[model samples]
Target: MSTPLTVVCWNFENNGKGRPDLRAAGADLLRRLAPDIALRQELWDADAHGHKIFNEQTRALGLQGVLGAESCTAVFYNPAKFSVVRGWAQGRGPHFVLPPTALTLRYEDAGPDSLPFNAVSYHLNYASAEQRLLEAEWLTTWADKGWTTPGRSHHTLPAILAGDNNSYPTSSPGDLPLPDLNTVKNEPHRLHRSYAGPSGARLPDTRPDTAFRTAGLKDAALYWATAPHGDPSALSRTVNASHTHGPDSRVDRAYLTPELLAALTGFEVIEVDEALSDHHILRLTLNGDLLSDVLAPSMSA
Candidate 1:
């Protein structure tokens, strides 16, 4: 059996005016949360200062940190719990504003042949729902291919794609309705053409929820909604909690492959000081034992 692994996915917001204080507050939150792995978005500066700040933060938490190109995204892991086997940034494409950072890690004490899983930290386009949908499709397609890729030295393992998805899980009744284009005076800036249905009819929901589900990924928070634990009432309250960005909607998320979905043990959207970030931090815990399962003989060989 393997130990439980706690992961946190957060959009730190761009490092700009008042960044010092925000970074400090974010670091403090990380210390308090103490996740085994942290998948971060919008670190925003690839310069020396960004590297220095990220390094310091991870060091303070006693974790190993890897920052992606242009400081777009990052991944920090507790070295005592897992060792990075391979790390790379996804290929840049038109739909992606920032390519995701991918890492494959093996438990520190596991045998050399033990299976290792992949974790991808991503940030989809926030300005356009159309762009966000296209990006989500690309991401899910990439994940499916990666998970099914052939002939690896080690066994195949599950994948966890987490970060600022900037969308909802589904068009559920509880979800905030998308404003009608005409109601908003056909404002060019506010209208999301991608959300329009056949013949340009406004969609009731604008989130890219279905696109992801069709790609074989499951929403972690949604999974917890049906299988409540701890305070049952809190499950609904926590899952529906809004305004990770300004006071309107919950956008940050973590999506897992079917294999990893079965191992999900806990999920939560944590609220923190707005000064720290406009977005809330998302936490997900999984049973590491399930992740250690190897692929069938044909694939493993």
Candidate 2:
């Protein structure tokens, strides 16, 4: 018998913008949520003080992890659930968080020869649809047999990418209505999430999410809500709707390839007291029986 694998993605408004950095609080919340994997963004100075901040946080969460080192993103996994393989960061800064990071790990109890999979933490450009499209293009490469990293070996492991995508998901028409471009409060969403149409009309650009889905990956929330055995109530926004801080939208997401999708068992948009983070948490659960099966293909190979 195998246990469930729980994963979470959060943009915890790091770096104290007119507010104090709640690194401690955020980790405590993650610990309570008890995800087997956690993806984080916007650590502001995550590598500050010789990585004191990040190290302390991960310690509190009881997970071993890796930092993008150059960007403000990180991927941490439960050491007991999987053994660490190698972690790497890709892309250049001034585009996305710390260049987007990934961690590879093979499941525990699997023999040394067992194949490992990867989990990625990424944050797309918040200012340009074109840039976001480019980011998605880079990410879609994972659906193929391998993804090339400039300075590393070809990464061929099955992987999942999750984080603050920052734009609405184009793959699914989520339960919330599209942001109103006409409203003054929605200017950011309009300017960032929409593309100019033929007659200068603003149309929501979904190329980012669409590219991932088109690459044959499943958007976890959408898949969970729509799958026959999934809970329909799980369909909702990833950001807190009641707050006027930004447009009500589901900007955070997790995308899984066929093997991981097959193991997916549960999904949730965890609403936390914003005193801890700006965005809600997205938690996904996968059946370890199915996950462990895919990680060891030699038996069938």
Candidate 3:
């Protein structure tokens, strides 16, 4: 009997900025979704109010939340379903202001079939494409089995990395054109989303997402919807047009290691209520068979 595990990732736009009263609406929406795990970005002051709001909302939804760097990024899981074995934030300080919260979790009620799985909730740097690329490279280390922490602990587990990547994939969906940088009045976005082209023209920089694919991870959305040429309607854009001031594009994403990819059962982008968050939610579902098959010792005959 395989259990379906749902994972959702979202950038709650500074955890519902400018609408403090509506802050809990995001968690309320998440409660309706009933995700087993959630990866969040731009959760401004998640530890604020004496961790009152954050704790209350998450607990009400049966989620155990762990604050990441600057309390901006976080990972939440159902305590009854899983327990965090090892969790920490990576790429802090000069590298990324909101580092990815990485964790290895073990199934709670499983005996020997219990296997560790890795997950990361990341909000990549928004001011520099080069910096974001470096962050992507750092994430690939998990799939590469080269990840090590300051404590000298290492992990080589089937992993899921998700959140606001802050950039588009190397190839936009269906060869669809990205938003024109010339129209983007946001100076930081104009500078970060593109690099100089011929004669100093602006061109979209896709190296960040390319880095993850070049490694061993598969983007869950792309793998489920379409590999090379994706169906744009199916892989809907995540950004809110009003918020961007320019043509909005899909920026939120989720990636999985090979074994986990095989376990993916469903993937979707939920158009969240704008009152709750500006960015749509990216949801991925995988079967629990992954727990036992994640680390296959040898190739099948």
Candidate 1 C-alpha lDDT tens digits along 77-129: 98888888777654535557777777887665445555567778888775677
- Using Cα atoms with residue i matched to residue i, what is each candidate's TM-score against the true structure? 0.81, 0.87, 0.86
- Go through the candidates in order and give the clash count of each: 0, 1, 0
Predictions in order: lDDT: 0.66, 0.74, 0.74
Model 2: runs farther than 4 Å from truth? 15-21, 90-98, 145-156, 171-174, 184-189, 242-247, 298-301
**C-alpha RMSD between model 1 and the true structure:** 4.2
Best-to-worst TM-score order? 2, 3, 1
Q: What are the RMSD figures for all models against the true structure? A: 4.2, 4.0, 4.1
Off by over 4 Å in 3: 18-20, 90-94, 146-155, 172-176, 185-187, 197-200, 227-233, 242-244, 295-301
The local lDDT score (0 to 100) that residue 203 gets in candidate 1 is 55
Better of 1 and 3 by TM-score: 3
The 10-residue segment of model 2 with minimum total lDDT is 89-98
By TM-score, who's the top model here?
2
Estimate candidate 3's alpha-carbon lDDT, on a 0 to 1 scale: 0.74
Sliding window of 10 residues with minimal summed lDDT for model 3: 292-301
Candidate 1 error regions (>4 Å): 16-18, 90-94, 145-156, 173-189, 192-194, 204-207, 228-247, 293-301
